[model samples]
Target: MVGVSKRVEAPSQGNREFTMTYANFAHIRDIAYDLTGITLSDHKQNMIYGRLARRLRALGLSSFDDYCNLLSEDSPELHEFINAITTNLTAFFRENHHFDFLKTTAFPNIIRKNMASKRLRIWSAGCSTGEEPYSIAMTLSATAGFSQWNAKILATDLDSNVVDKGRRGIYQEDRCTGIPNEYTRYLKRNPSTGEIKIREDVQEKIAFKQLNLLHQWPMKGPFDIIFCRNVVIYFDQETQKKLFARYHKMLAEGGYLFIGHSENLNRVSNDFTSLGKTMYQKK
Candidate 1:
């Protein structure tokens, strides 16, 4: 049960602040957990308040209770709510070392072993805005004879907004700064607006879709690599355990898993062994 209070209190601003009591905040947190498997701690109160405040105005609702009621009553609105609250902070070659390993070791080994099949399968789970999958595409495109192989990357996120952006394969020119010089071949420049784009060839290798990791996955996989980096950090221990188990099942034996630098599987999982940094190998 959420903590329901009689008195509604809003933080004071110049005019009016969003009214969110501890009870309402608790309910929101619970819904987020139930829907997306993300555990929002108490400290995220201000963040939740700030973001959902806009939703309240858009819906013409005055109270957090009304918003929570709408959430229970409506399904489509829940999707919008999830899209709004989810954090999507990603960039090209983020935590670059993982991609380095892929270019130097994993991809080469997998490609060599799979040369006859001429197929490469990679999944960028929780791939926000497509940078990670685009990075995967560039890594393959940079490697020797990558075109000979039928490479594919499955990029997915819970946020439909970010997934659509990734599918568009366009980014502000400044956002492409972190791309390495060797892999710059995969980017094209639009002189009209100076926007940077993932080359169509590279873009073709990826499929962007909206997915919630807690839910059932539609695609069957024996993927060579999976990047769930900076994603499960928000999940509870049990949720992380289940997800890692699913990742283990989805991966080929000795396949790679790349997680956030701060994340670990020490206590939560035994299906994977650390290969240093945030990389893990299925055991």
Candidate 2:
């Protein structure tokens, strides 16, 4: 029902190993929308085929219809299906401006505003691997007085694989190259192994969990800041509306919302006032 961009005839079966009929693609898109609020456009058919084909091969399923049937039965492969479809491209300090904004504005404002409570809560929704939340943790650790404050970050993703990876806090050495020199103190590098790990103290500041944005959230939050960057771009306008409304309810007074560079709240929801560079403050 959701993300039905268009209907087109299935492509010619030239040299392809498996068949992905239009009906099969349609069913998969519907399932994806229901499960993750992602709008899979027609252009993504090849990508979807490429990703899910591995599952088909692994399960020894011969065709998309068979795979669809397995999914229809709510097979355990559903998790793998979601994981395959979701994108996890990320980097340390991927959007440097957001961190800069935090260091210069949000953190100071929150520090002044919540001096009595000395509490800070941040959520990194759709945190791919550990980079985004680790970046947040590094930023917080670099802040002068936050060490004594009750600061915690919640990092969550729909993909269980990435969630587990994030929880481990280990990454390839090159994956951390973009981390600022000043914030590098929070990381440790294994010289021989070429692996980088977030220090235990910094790692302790975050809690990683596998979560679906479309599902019920377990934690009751009036979070001070939420970094849901590059996430809502997948959802349709209606889905975005509901999501932002929920975010408005979850945020503390004057809480900040940081979105992706390519994402905009315009024509989606007016619950937050845009602060430029994809940053927003709850109205």
Best model number under TM-score: 2
**Cα lDDT of model 2 by residue, 1-283, tens digit:** 6745658776676888998988999999999988899998887888898899999999999999899999965679889999999999899999899999999999999999999999999999999898999999988888877767999999999999999999999999889899989988888889999899899999999999999998999999989999998899889889999999999999999999999999998888888999999999999
Q: What's the lDDT of the predicted structure labeled candidate 1?
A: 0.88
Model 2 RMSD, rounded to 1 decimal: 1.3
* Candidate 1 structure quality by residue, lDDT tens digits, 1-283: 2233343443443454566887787889888888898888777878898899999999899888899888884567999899989999989999999989998999888977788988789999999999999988888888886777878999999999999999999999889999999988888899999999888988999999888998999999889999999898899888899999999999987899999988999899999888999898989
Worst 10 residues of 1 by lDDT: 1-10
Candidate 1, which segments miss by more than 4 Å at Cα? Answer: 1-15
RMSD of every prediction: 2.7, 1.3
Residue 151, model 2, lDDT: 96
lDDT score for residue 150 of model 1:
77
The residue pairs found clashing in candidate 1 are 3-23
What number of backbone clashes does candidate 2 have, counting pairs of residues 3 or more apart or in separate chains? Answer: 0
